[model samples]
Target chain A: MMQALVTCRGLTKVFGKGELAVHALDGVDLDIHRGDFATLAGPSGSGKTTLLNMIGALDKPTSGEVTIEGTPLSTMSKAALSELRLEKIGFIFQAYNLIPVLSALENVEFVLQLQHVGAAERRERATAALHEVGLAGMESRRPSAMSGGQQQRIAVARALVSRPSIVLADEPTANLDSTTTAELMELMSRLNRDNGITFVIGTHDPRVMAHSQRHIEMIDGKIESDTND
Target chain B: MNNFGILRTIAWRNLWRNPKRTLITLIVVTVGLWSILAFSMLLNAWAESSRQNALGLLIGQGQIHAAGYMDDPNIDHLMPPPDGALRDVLDSDGVAHWVARLQLPGVVQSEYKTLPITILGVDPAGEREISLVPDKIVEGRYLNGLDDDAVIIGANLAKRLKTTLGRRIILMSTGADGYLEEYSFDIVGIFDADQGFEDSYVFTGRSLLQEYMGLDDEIAQISFVLPDESGLPAMIDTLKAAAPDLDIRDWKQVSVMAAAMNSAMKSIIYIWLGIMIIMMSIGIINTQLMAVFERTQEFGLIRAIGLKPRMVLWLVTLESALLMAVGMVLGVILAVLTYFGFQGGLDLSGFSRAMEAIGSGQVLYPQFAPADFVIYPVLIWVIGVLVALWPAYRAQKISPVEAMRHAT
Candidate 1:
């Protein structure tokens, strides 16, 4: 009965047309509630990543609608969508996309700065965000100087610093080892519990599935099953 | 952080990511600008010396002649010496120095050769202040008095005539009576002027020539030298009103070749500017475009993090502005040092013959104008920013999809 932070109804995505047509997503319905730590687990070429991108407002769906907090994405301009992404959503990629030239602290502060936060508050919030993710002493180090787990932690800090409504992570632990993956998932699960920030992760890792409150199985371009913990 | 501050920080950091590329582009911009500055100074030095050399050759800064004197050089086209109100005008502060000369086309025969030349009948006292003939005496001495009856000719002319100092020569010209007048004169001085002037002119005292041609108190022209050319127009107007019967002309009008040379030099400078702008514009476009293309993923990352496309454009432009500033500073410093290297003057003595052909002297002192400093830097910044816009536009077109990729 909790309010849905994101709603995907009969969503479909097609990459090409005619004989060369490829369906990246099929008709699917899903609801992501506030504070839900969910995972869309499937093998490669499934529609889980496409679904994540649709809900993140990063790409458009071919049919059906994606509504974030009752605002339909189809009606927004590119600028409005970008503003929505800045204000409402956070993203973590498997590759850990951080600006190489920026320090870990600067990476964390990047979103807050985009939100036009003041320098004093931006630094304070970014410092606290890094500390919350157990990266307190590594704030000034660049991504190249940090390990895969540390860089993912910095990415997590960057995502959570602005207190976005939903965090859409696409295979965020693909590059990490089992120990680091469990540690990162536990840190994210704790943040999800404490901050009430919803998480929608797309992955096939059982370790990731074990930590989620809900798990949806995807095959090809459609959702095959949905289950709750 | 403020919006521009954030943008500037990223832009500044982006430049040093590839230090070699940045330094190479910096050197290109620096050398391009420095060449414009240093070459302009060198050209200006040569132009200034050529103008001085042209002005010194008997045609001071301005001149006054009888209404038809320049049209015909005989005694029939002569004007009365400066007197009455005209004398007072010449004595004013506006006129630095003035000399009366009865210039006539005549023949000089040294027994071995006969050459046609223009004879300048000068006042020794006045010529000392305003004429090259008085100061260019390489042998013997200048004419001493109005009745001295001695002539000064260039060393080249003396060699042509097989004549030397103290040698007697026949100076013949048309008299006031419309008959041939012949006078004997001693070669008092052999003056050495530039190549062109050296071979065509001979100088004698005004009174001696006046008496010899049977025309007393009549002169062909009165040349005046001013402190500078800025007051030349006003001085011309003042003389026109004071001496309506006489024709007044500026040195530019009297020496048409020098005027043409000045105009041609200005055109060449504009051509140099055109060439520099085209070359530098292409250089900036390529360098800035390469820098933009190399950071496509980074651009996309910033854009995905809520940076607007226009802001990406601004970020790229900021990077170019920084490069321009560094280049301009380096260029000005290098140009100033290069100018100082010519402190003693850029000696063209090795090319003395070539220098004389164009009327410039052997030694040239290079100096820059204040406008060169202000104009060159401003031009570089404006042109650089404009030329960098294509790359910035490409940066703005980076899609958010690129942000998903790993850095290269």
Candidate 2:
């Protein structure tokens, strides 16, 4: 039995007030264990992305708790959450988010730089991460110079370089073509299978669900089905 | 690089991303500082020239008169020459130079015309050290001695009297007995002074005037000049101790208008500088806020990547600081060049009449005190960084969630 890395109990998120309020998330209870490759599949306006954001500590829930490795996010300060994000979680965005000013290697090392990692060690780790993402000699190039696929790979390298326990990718393959999307899905699946790193991705694509070990379907902010179904 | 190194790298690279905007803002800062320094130097020199002009014309840095001579200048208001004790103090190191004169209101009559003037009876040797009029002899020689009896009148005075060098003139004044007396003297020198001085005063021998007035060495006043006016207060105190019965007055008291103008010029300079700084600060704030808006996603991305809001504030602040530093360097260089370029003096001869109206010279030589160089850079840099906090605070208040919306 795998240990639970993230546990959510009755999570809810509301936007606006009273008659005009919106329930972006409503009573979502779920568990993501270590070594599990999970996907929160839903249609547009569903609460999959909101649930992912709550787990990432990017947004707070209205009336629920998200426990990451047994520490409740409700009890953490904004500063402590920031430290937790730096040390315990990695994020890969759909738009291939990379600092335009920094080189690929520098972008990868940016989080480590904030973590107070020594220069030589951080450089070595960033270089290894870049190689693992299939971008061996492209370490010095900027994001603009790389193709969309290569840029997304650099984003993956940045996420993995920080050695976070879980990488929450929000629609990571939304912008990629079928060929590049297949390649990225396979790469992330390999990283999960070989390294036992947990991955919780949010998407509506059935192809993405096919690669995950656990599929939790959501509609109108509630889980409609899961691996148990 | 360390954390600060990362921030600096980002700031420097971010500044150059839009080179045109950065350059424009930098130019504003540069031009502002350059104008302040250059204009300050010019005004300082002009003020200095005004003070020197006020001190040189007739009022030395200070003067000594008989108890009531300042209020009324006549035979009845005369005082005896300095006694041994007073003379010793007047000869002290504090007194750079002193000249005793018998200045009286009188009339000079030439063959063709007659004009009213202040008759200044001066010792020629002592007068040269304290007065520029003696050295400003353009037509004839300065006075010779107390026994020479050769009068040196202003060039304009000579014109009004229809007189020239070697011409005979009769000077009439009241004697010690309250009776009118007169003497004939040769015009030996005609000095071309400033516009006002040229027609207002005439010079003669001290003892010769004393003889004509039937007084044995009684004089009206002694005028003193110091090497620098900075020591005037201390030296005036010493001079007062020596001549307790006589009246003493510093240049500011003797020339009230010049003193007031000096203060007014300084206030105007500070006010102008304040206005320029405010304008520059507005330009900086506007430029930086625009830069912040353009890099909104970049800031959001960093905040999501574990950079706290305060660090974002520092990052933006550092960017502004770098911009100001670049401008300050160029500004200081340009200001130095401007100062040296006008070192020979900025010619304002076209405004000569206006300058003369204010009793200043035609050329203004820009100068700076030692303190200006040290204080200006520190003050400008500190204030410049402080003004940038507005944009930095705006950057800090951005939410990390904006990163997802503006991920591109």
Candidate 2 residue pairs that clash: none
**What does candidate 1 score in Cα RMSD to the true structure?**
2.6
- What is the fnat of model 1 with respect to the true interface contacts? 0.35
- Per-prediction DockQ scores? 0.48, 0.60
**Docking level of model 1:** acceptable
Q: Write the per-residue lDDT of candidate 1 for residues B1-408, one digit (tens) a residue.
A: 777887788788888888898888888889988988888888888888898888887888998998887777677788888888888989988888998888999999998999998887888987888766677899999889888888888899999999899998898899888888988889988998886687888888888888888897888989998877799999898899889988899989888988888888777777887787787778778888898777777776677667777888999999998988899999989989988899789999999889988788899999778798779778877988888888998888887765554442
lDDT of 2 by residue, B1-408 (tens): 788999999899889888998999899889988888887887888888887776786788888888888888887788888878789988877678998899999988999988888888888898778888887899879888877778888877888888788899999888888888888888888887666788878888898888888889989888898877789998888888888888988988877877898898788778877887887788789889999898887787777778877889999899989998888889888998888888888999899878877667789888766576657766877887899999999999887776566763
Using DockQ, give the best candidate's number. 2
Give Cα distance to truth, residue B45, candidate 1, Å: 1.4
* Model 1 agreement with the true structure over A155-196: per-residue lDDT tens digits: 899988888999989899999999999999999999988888
Q: How much does each candidate deviate at the interface, measured as C-alpha RMSD after superposition?
A: 2.4, 1.7
TM-score of chain A of 1: 0.97
